[model samples]
Target: MRKIIFLGALIGLIAFSCARLDSFLFNPYKTDEYKLDAYDGKLQFRLGPEFDIPQDKIHLFSISSQGYKIWGIYIGDTTTISSDTVILYCHGNTGHIDYYWQRAKLLAHVGGKLRYGVLIFDYRGYGKSEGEPSEEAIYEDTKAMMQWLKDKGLTGDRLVIYGYSMGTAPATYWSSHDGPLTPRWLILEAPFASAELMVQDGAYFVLPKQYVTDLEINNAEWIKNAKAPLLLFHGTEDKLLALDPHGKTVFDNHPGPKQAVFVEGATHSDVPVILGIEAYISEIYNFIKSH
Candidate 1:
């Protein structure tokens, strides 16, 4: 009995340690409602009146992922989803859709007004979504969204997968893996290399990423397998993930047709604003057309 008790205690200790490390990785929070324009005071750039989306085009919906109801905002009419090229926006480790609303709005106006459909969502524990955020849960949540889009007649050729910061893990995972859908284009903005690199950067020493969390988020390795045309955006002055070990590392490891725009004086969240709205949109538009 004593031996069995000792083994159980050891297993409990390891699980506790893993849980502590997970807290450092995911930063999801609860919000009563997504107040797109009036919430969060952290937005550095806000769109003008001309950039406002028509009420008829905006959609707020939810779908099931691993028994959890994942919420999303689709910035176009459902009828257009079958024909228009859509962007499945996997947001960073921030709050929720409200936080990334401006970015999604910008994507809606990429080539012209409502030229491309944009879908941004709250991962399972963020905002009004159900359940907690785990490494696997986020991946499943993303897959669920893809299934929802597929049901709407969205084809793989019209799908563009865009990931920012922590969202890069799921974006790269789906791109690299043989799944139900493959992205027509993969766009990564300020991506971190891997969970291992993240843990090392935080501790200032090399350590096994599993010691902190069991997440298999390795963008550097996954990008090697992604064949879709890639467009990478990184800021030279990004202090959050840095240019060398994070963005550059992932960009270099990609073994396919890729284009990168290393913006000057832009930080992690300021890439779009610093790159200038017109130049940023033009780059994405031209890349999508050429590829």
Candidate 2:
């Protein structure tokens, strides 16, 4: 009867983990509250007919992510993929690629010249991407993106990875794990140290420690082996993760050539504009050129 009892216990454990899987891995806010097609004059850019349709600027494409379709957009001219230095912009947890096109526009101006191209995408379960969200899932999806760039002849130093907020997971993951495919320059903005720390601080700080699942982003451990020149920026007044715990920890843990900027009085999403576009661009360009 011992074998039967053990089987029952194992089944119960699997059921519990399956039930909590989505809760642990993703915080997807699936709502039609935002439709990028109607880019109101009030907002800079939207993914809808009103915006991209007018200029038809965004080139939409698909990539295979674990047997499912995931979406990505090229924010500049079609030739820019071949001509310009590309930064694959991995955005934060909430919202889709439509919400981040404005960021693409800002990153296009590299050191006062339109030198950099931007590619932004929605992970599975975020925007139009297929399947559910998980740490490995996001990593493979982003790996497909790097392959796309290689196929387009953008290789080695020409490609850069930039991660914002929750997007830092895949950004750090690829840079640390992707061997030859890894780019030399990595730009991380408001990065979380790890999955558990992020959920602990943001979700349930008061509760005791628990290992609900193996959803480890592991940015701290990943950066130790990352040889690339890392440019990290964090806001002092961030409403989400505090600079002292999250960003600072990641910066400290990195054992490579790195530089960090602490923006005074700036909160999350304010790194670009708060420092003034020209100066911020200069900082980015200097990091890119020198590295």
Top candidate, metric TM-score: 1
lDDT of 2: 0.74
The best candidate by lDDT is 1
Candidate 2 positional error at 179, Å? 5.1
The digit string of per-residue lDDT tens for model 1 on 1-291 reads 999999999998987753556756689867867887676557768988888998888899999998998899999989868898999999999878888899999899889989999999989898899999988888889888988888898988999999999888888988998766888899999999998998898899999887777778899999999978899999999999998889999999998799999999999988999999989888898888899
> Which residue pairs in candidate 1 have backbone atoms (N, alpha carbon, C) closer than 3 angstroms, thus clashing?
none
User: How much is 209 displaced in model 1, in angstroms?
Assistant: 1.8
Question: Which residue runs of candidate 2 sit more than 4 Å off their true CA positions?
Answer: 1-25, 29-37, 40-57, 80-83, 199-210
- What lDDT score belongs to each candidate, Candidate 1 first? 0.89, 0.74
lDDT of 2 by residue, 1-291 (tens): 999999999998887764445445476544333344443333322222222222455678888867878888776666656656888888887667657766665676665434676778877777778788777777887888888777787775787899998888788877788543678788899888876776677665644225444576778789877767899989899878778788998899888689998888878877776766667777888999999
What TM-score number comes out for model 1? 0.92
What's the TM-score of each model vs. the native?
0.92, 0.81
